[model samples]
Target chain A: MLHAPASPQADLQSEPNDFSAILAEQTDRLLAQHVTPACLKAADGGVFPAAAWEAVSDAWLPLALVPEAAGGVGLDAPAAAQILRRSGYHALPAPLAETMLGLALWSAAGGAAVEGPVSLATGLLRLASGTILAEGTMAHVPWAGAAGHVLAIAEAPDGARHLALLPRAAYTIVPRRNLANEPRETLHIGTAPLGPDALLPLPAPLAGPDGLMLFGAFARAQQMAGAMERCLDLAVAYANERKQFGKPIGRFQAVQQMLAVAAGESAAAGAAAQVAAAAWNTDQFPLAVAIAKARCGEAAGKVAEICHQVHGAMGFTQEHVLHFITRRLWAWRDECGNDAHWQERIGRMVCAQGGAALWPRLVALRAAANGDRGTQP
Target chain B: MPDMRFATVAFPKDAEDLRLQVRRFLEAEKADGRFVPHRSSWNTFDPDFSRRAAKAGYVGLTLPEAYGGHARSSLARFVATEEMLAAGAPCGAHWIADRQSAPQILRHGTQVARDHIIPRICAGECYFGIGMSEPDSGSDLAAVRSKAVRGAGGWVLNGQKIWTTNAHRVHYLLALVRTGDAGADRHGGLTQFIIDMAAPGISVRPIHDLSGNHEFNEVFFTDHFVADDFVVGEVGDGWSMVTQELAFERSGPDRFMSDYRLLTELVDRIGPAPDARQAVETGRLVAHMGALMAMSGSVAALLDRDIVPNVEAALVKDVGTAFERDIPEVARRLVAVEASLDAQDDRFAEALADVALRAPSFTLRGGTREILRGVIARGLGLR
Candidate 1:
């Protein structure tokens, strides 16, 4: 199965000013105004929620993959990741990750625009016969329970990349518990996957040595960032409310120090993730992605432990959401190419080249991703 | 701190071709075996050779032309340092002075100090050392007990300084002294002086590190006399001055390029197209260095713009040291080369063994990792 290279990005343009900040801010507004209020009302309309997706889709959140010409907001990678992370933070039990992942595949296929109640899954998918063959069941699929359109990626037997798009009704929603109590489910699609035309003949499924690791890392790092944020909020709330020695626990030095470290973990992780996502948005993929993954992976546990300690006995209790946050941190820490894995990868890349060879390597990666392999710098 | 700022980073858009020019110069130096490739390129002393280097307009490349300096951008100076370091040039005599002292003098020192010292430094003659940390203070810089009280003649100093690298050999010391008693807050009232090392009240004694290298020294000043004009910056501002110098100290190729020689050797020994594991190991390290270099280069550009990105600089130094220390470990793991403290092989092995033994100090020397994290934590609005 020879995968065709993705097209040279022709629609690479500057997004509107404050697009990311606006979208991030909208996560709260939409989550509170639309997502939460909407989801709590429609839990009986099947396990997968089309109502929520349709609402978000109408709001231009679903067409994140669409270019400016296609009547979409034309959000880039970083902006999308930011929205997804906030989605995680708000625990808006919706299939946003799925929609974005599918739209990503659709965008790669030169589709008109991405839309509908969508969801995304990360693992391996393959195309087989007339059916879009799917393999590699995705673990920790966010919003899997509420997705209307699920995009599952698999490598075909012929080596061509395939994207399987199943409607909300098609998936067997085997409910699963995620670290955070966000909606998750096991997606089992038959060999007769989705429609062939729906299985867009996309280029390589971004499963290369570094790209896959990076994308995976970015997603996990985003989730970890959300957990870190939640932890900080949890700790701050606990510190303010829990009193000891006739004062709030936050007044104590030891509590403050631990809280400080957790805050640091969040900042470093967020900084690294943002930088990486920003790089990806600008098409500087591998190096930025690797750095983000490494830093975020290291920060995940650090924030979790500090935060858990800050919560003390309450955190360990299921009644509180602290365990939920730490659990996500634990899961997401190893979700991408773990810290050790990416560190070794980065280390080896650095050692192999001359101190000054980074320029050529970057130029080469861009060219390759742009399907201009023979273009020498 | 969270402003939308842009750092141009240190890429001379059209000046990459100039690398060839520098490489040619280094090659010429290497041809006749004029370059020895010492273990400590910048720290290794070679006064005559350094004078030759300055004569080539390589030293003081960033200072103002009015002061006999080359008036080049920091990138150009960076180019010169990168080349010198890559070639293992013994730039000890003028390295610190060129990198730190001249800049301080040009920016903050008295006109007399700049006139007397700048041209000579540009010509690779006079040198200076940081006299910040005391014997008890260490990285707890605010704890500096080296006090200088105002006297009629100028000032009288009685204090002991430690870890003053190349201080014994340098012409002057930029010692931070308490000009007045500071209560509660340990950093108050400290002043920086361009202390002439040859003054009668000063005694410099070399203290070899655990590596048996006469790298640093302890200097005791008993009633050391200095003119009021000798102060580097305003009175009671030594802490800020030292903090600013740190942005200079921490953000440089020096942070990561310390053991780069060993890294290169490891790769050279690895040969072309390494096995899967080796490729993975070496590839990742090299990639990280690339990103680290880019980040550090960004900070350099930030410094060039006169916007002291202290937090960004701290990030660079912290991440840079972690990568540096990991280099030797990765290299050793890749190829189980015979490495030990007692080795006396080619200078390659000697340097590797030396760097391996000394790598622990990489994090410790430039503020410990713990402190760096604390700094970063604070910078991130976490503390």
Candidate 2:
């Protein structure tokens, strides 16, 4: 069902003047129309929704992060991130974020715009001479079997980095699934043969391990923020509708307090995601991304717990849509480096800079982000 | 999904310039032995420091130049406030008037009231205390029984207000008094009056807090006379006005930065090299602070647009005060020391002692946690 690529004529880019609002509205509408409870339930049976994929493709969401000069919509990082966030809010059962980042990275590495979904795995392939070879097994590659191509960042023997675009035939895949029942495949790329044109030198910022991790972490952070909002919404609606002791559960102060805390967490996660997304292309990427991922990841757990507690037994059932979002939140928080990992990185960075330098560092970071006028609010 | 609106806003470039000026002024004050850092916070009442700050044009930042203010944007004021809190400036003298009372007067007060009070407030010579909380009504502000009858001059007030911060020192009190029936909504018939502290039949008794500080007081009134011009807005409109004023009072750098001195002291005590535990814990606090700063800044932008983001403000107070309450608990766990207020040589210990004693009131002041959460839930449509 996921074999065919979307047609080039399916481009549905909004006008450049007010693209963010339009794109957000369109994405929300698309998700509301296609991602219903029945469709989500059917998707739990491991059936890929071809119609949903086509609708998203028709909206050109997968190409949101790509530059306009690269035959893509060329929305700013925050705009693109809003697309991912809305997708997460809908619990989109596809590799939308991965594909968006994949196409951006591929085009940045001098590759042509690829049509189908593209999965990404870091530090799995090595470049020798003119051919790209797989170094080890790449685990937890989202939609590896479903993607038309897999992009991996490989380092050569001389320590130079390169991005290799491997076709589906180049590697063997073992299908896996995340906690949300979404495909998370493993790629066994042992001595895969790639043409010379497939391997391109990785750019400076994108070449490092921190860069890839930060990128993936920010993506998940946005997703977690979106999913958290959905959870809070579900819990609140349930509280207002569900009856207990002859009154709506929401009438109880205890439930209201829990929902309030969840709202706070959701707001914090959303704000953190915005900060990270706004600083996506700035020199403050590492610090911003680290804080975003860590904060969002932490919020994800607390929000999920509060939501579940407010929901009671009804929320724990697979029949309810709440678990669909909470499960994805659980999966997303652990992927691409969890909160502890990013927190440790931040801890090391701040401690290394010492106590007094911390404020100055944050001020400098804010200055750097503000200096990039293109994305300034 | 829930529509959560927290649009991230960049502090204006000119705000950065203002930040530099604030930093320079603070540094010079410290150098001249005017005020000691870590010895004061927003809650510390120091009229001398407030006078200095007003002289430097840091007070009443959002008010217009005609009202003795600098006519700066809210973001500029936000920058100045963060600087004050981070430096542990004793801004309590002008905090209430500059933060909410003056804005309330400018927005809803009578023209006579505004003309009589706002300029003095901006000059840092006048201070105000909130009188919404009566002896019987703490978080249930609607339960206020401070009756005011239409008498000779304006209103004859007779009631008592407890936990009135700076009531003993301030020049005026913004009191919410019951003037008529509560109607069916329990919000009507209430009115706010700007009562002079030195008015006849008005008395203030000091209430020492846990830290041995007489910062709060129990204010009593027996037939206290309030001038007709001192009434704020229309009578029976106090509930909505006070609720709107809370959006300004609840969400600012002040809510979260109350205990910032402790965090700074913790970082300074940890020094350049910290263990994994200290770094992880401190880093988490820093990340939380950064997020809160962004949220608070967004609210500031909303205030600048003349939008009352009551729900967003409630969320900030709920989250920000919780963050403040956690700072001292986290700091004490990270270091081994006997927290003492008299530790002159150990600023960290002193700060820890001060914060530990004060953290319980963080969520209680402005509004209690329970009240804020209820407001948020209603905003979320859960109620």
TM-score of each: 0.79, 0.94
For candidate 2, what is the lDDT?
0.83
Worst 10 residues of 1 chain A by lDDT: A368-377
lDDT of each: 0.65, 0.83
lDDT of 1 at B77: 73
DockQ of each: 0.17, 0.51
Deviation in angstroms for B150 in model 2?
Answer: 2.0
For candidate 1, give the lDDT. 0.65
lDDT per residue for candidate 2 within B201-233, as digits (tens), equals 899999999878998999999999898888888
TM-score, candidate 1, is 0.79
User: How do the residues A267-311 of candidate 1 rate in per-residue lDDT, one tens digit apiece?
Assistant: 556655555555553445566667666666677788788877877
* lDDT of candidate 1 over B260-353, digit per residue (tens): 6676666666665567677667755654455455556566767877978777777777777878899888877888667765455554466678
